[model samples]
Target: MAASVGRGAPAAGPEAGGALWAEVWALLPGTEEGLTLALSGEVDDCVRPLLRRARGLLYGAEGRPGEEAAAAALRRLGDVLRDYSWEKLNAGPWREISKAWRQVYTYGCLFGALAEVAAGRPLAPAVRLCDMGLLMGASVLDNVLARLVRVLQQHLPREQRRGAAGLAAESVRTEPRPAPAVRPEDALPRLRCPSLEHFRDNYLIPQKPVVLEGIMDHWPCMRKWSVDYFCQVAGCRTVPVELGTRYTDEEWSQKLMTVGDFISQYIVNENSMGYLAQHQLFDQIPELKEDISIPDYCCLGEGEEEHITINAWFGPEGTISPLHQDPQQNFLAQVFGRKYIRLYSPQDSENLYPHESQILHNTSQVDVEDPDLVKFPNFRKAAFQSCILMPGQVLFIPVKYWHYVRSLDVSFSVSFWWS
Candidate 1:
């Protein structure tokens, strides 16, 4: 579908510049009134002119003379925005960053989508553009690109949305699910679809950890999620992944890559350990969120429940999360694969040898699997409960309970944390 706009040079003027704005505006629905760009600070100063010039390329009285340049400019503007955003986003101290950086990202996405639209792409490719933007950008701009993409998507058939191939047909690499290295002296209690009152009294109120079964059998993910499924829907979406063994390692660092590439290189090929850990992946990809549901356990409270903090952990076998604890209670749901998890009661914190630094105060210095009895002699006294959390199982971890986790195979887990 060749764009109606011109691909070569055409006349330019103030009229053309203003018309370019109109062109993008007119392409989407319900924008007859107007549209606005949400930009701020220094990043805005650099991005404004690029966007204006790109718009300037779309305007022309005859043949839309600046059309090709407009299309090119839009694509280039997206790249420019990403470069600027990365400069700030990739810097250290991730938890301290604000949404201002993401605003610039939205501009890039909007313009990128505009470029894709101008090129007259098919529905899937166009939707991919919007998906990437949504995955990376903040809620800024008028959502012009998203709106346009939605309009295009209405014509898409349901089969295409679900994908042509099933995940079973496309196993990249299959391997044995690991058996526990050290069998637990004790195992967590499991209840089949326990009632809310029963769970609250036995677990929540008492601050006891338990493995929940039967509640998640209905979740769509149990049947639908697979390597091929992710590649089909989110192959192009970029996600941050931890590199080099684990975060505790001196060489450990994070890198951003498309999910497909991550799956191919780290998951399928087993080049090196790359864990997509502690990311709000559900927020990044809401369509995937539909496959799972928040536990009713999180909703139990006085008047109203606070928002749950959800994170995704996706990686291959042997990925380790060093001993750590969080302030809030956690429901660690195993969507697929198994994880050998060990949990020590908060009373045993002294034996855990927590890091003295404020940043890692909640993290224990002693390795749970291979403790150094000489240096961390107290660790041996810590009593812990353990389990091999399997698919469709949810492990309730009480607040401040010291725990360590190791994946047994390629895995995907979602955690919901609440105060």
Candidate 2:
């Protein structure tokens, strides 16, 4: 991902130079957080000395060295911070470990960003450095790197960015998925951008699922999001890709890789199943967030737009989400390709055979499409509604409703969850 700055870009100009020598130079000092923030044990011990060394670099104390000296020292500290956090990520619980480590990663990005600017590096690699911090850190350096990313992207030559997914999208084999062995009793009702009152009265109050049409045609994402677009916009940024048949499998695991690497190995070659599921990618890559607008229907819930949770679901055909239920209302909007979804009411919870484990209690143990009927006989009695959600459509899933999803084509869907 950290390919050379000259890899795919043209010559840099004066405006880019100002971003380097002026705005970015001013922002770097603010990232000197190690001196103020206190961590426990060996981690604190690691950060303290880095701060002491970097103090003179950012603070401009008496006899502080030139920009080259600052760049050299900061780059070394950045490398150590990144490696320290990386070791912790592989050693402990993801959620708990990522907390303090992300703060460490933030400093790494800060140091890396300052180093890139001081050295007058080209825009492409510099943009990737900013992206690493944005994607992997907590408490980002006051959105400074995000702003830098936007500025650098503007200067990148437009000719290199692909308008559509191109050959990668074209290469998807259109193998039709066979019919579900446990078919739905009925199809979910389809509506064309119904009014708030109508949707609330008919579906929301009753907590029923519905397939929505005419709502997503206006979203720029429908036309703009594709493999090539991601390759251009976020090719160098790392993302967590889920591997194996499904999450329920004993073999399931996650690996971090660049977006370009994920596309090449999974989306194009189809050698492995790598799903980038349930990620807040919009916050990480703000440029991509501009393509889609939140639906008016989300306003029906409290906090309206602010309360909504956005997640990106991108993977090749055959990725499966075993039966599960969420606690909030969801609008699953298909930006491209198709997905087969089936839903069961909360009243059928007993029949759905939810896992007994405390962590997986919301998820059903039974596979909806290929049920082991002899082992779970009650699953046969579970009534369900189904849909093959298409592009330019959104599926409304009520809270606590058991649902399963499978990709029918190379797919990209943005899900919005609200209480």
Candidate 3:
């Protein structure tokens, strides 16, 4: 018979409304203290060897004995069930509780008669009966897992939820500001390509922003890592975050899966995010010393042209960079499509109504289109710099300059920084 319960079924009713836990409890001896201890300890010890084997098998590691594979998988599943029990005992945040319950609800049905049998007094016959078929039974495990994840995510802070929703929203209604003249002082110095001595003397010490468009033009990624190439070479590594509109739980799942896939599958995300900080890759590229790395598909090319990088492929309308500033001077290069950037200078801090704290002073309030002048009257006079970065164009953003970025189309970019 099928195992697993549906929500809204009265827990007090006969058969407990198909509840998996109810079935397990029904098969067990009375829930006495001695029985609880015996069951918990036996489950813990009996499952250890299986867990060890399963851990190695799941990751495709070598050296696990062939005979141990089934035991290992079973042990891992048992551990998951054990944790589910503990979760109920220690209820804290709704999300944490929901997650634990969800795991049990989805995977419990798959555990089959073993879940019921194990909860009961251990018998010789029960031991012999436990087999692979017990685990293969269809259960509501995956569905329950999905629902729980959604419930937990929906509990995010209202502001954060709003911000996340705006990720894919249509661009602001205000007309684009007129382009500013690119004065020589505003341009990054045209130093000889790779040496740090020149970059420091010209750009770093003085805090100048420069566009190094031609420098990395030859990097393999510059030409090959387009959306099509990414989907082909990397496969679903780019996430689809909601930059503008509210996302259903299903939409959020798609976004998260895509983001997680990108991070797990790509070397660029790993390397750029400092996962390989001590590896030979860093030794080969000196430009990365000052770049604050983010976990995304950022890469450094070989040869003297290696640049510290932060990159992401935005799908449809993707992650909109909330208005914030980084610590280091920036060299943001657009390699595909277009990205809109709005900038506010550090000198204009008073008019920008910077927060009192030194570290977070660069962050700006939302609702930029309509500011409450009574609270921050000076915001109206704040000087603004704006640009729409196109493929092969790089924009220099000095430290502490407030910036809000929007992907104009499916886009990708490489951003580098140096002290």
Best by TM-score: 2
Q: What's the TM-score of each model vs. the native?
A: 0.79, 0.82, 0.45
Error (Å) of candidate 3 at residue 160 is: 33
Runs in model 1 deviating more than 4 A are 1-33, 39-64, 79-98, 120-136, 141-169, 172-178, 181-185, 301-306
Q: How big is the positional error of residue 290 in model 2, measured in Å on the Cα after superposition?
A: 0.9
Candidate 2 residue-wise lDDT, 345-387, digit = tens: 9999999989999988998999887899999999999888898
**Could you tell me the lDDT of residue 365 within candidate 3?**
56
- Model 3 misplaced stretches (Cα beyond 4 Å): 1-198, 236-255, 259-313, 317-319, 355-362, 366-375, 417-419
All-Cα superposition RMSD per candidate:
6.1, 5.8, 16.6
**Model 2: what TM-score?**
0.82
Ranking by lDDT: 2, 1, 3
> In candidate 1, where is summed lDDT lowest over 10 consecutive residues?
2-11
Candidate 1, 99-127: lDDT as tens digits: 77766666667667666556544446655
- Each candidate's number of clashing pairs is 1, 0, 17
1-419 per-residue lDDT for model 3 (tens digits): 11112121112233323343343344333322212211112233434443333333323332334323322343446556545544453556544444424334223322322322223322222221221112111113222222222222233233332332232222312233343343443333343254556555665556554444455555555555543343222231112333222121223332222332432322222222111111221222222222223211122212133444443334333335656777755677676667666777777766776556665566665435457888888887876656567676667677777777765555556565533
Per-residue lDDT for 318 in model 1?
A: 86
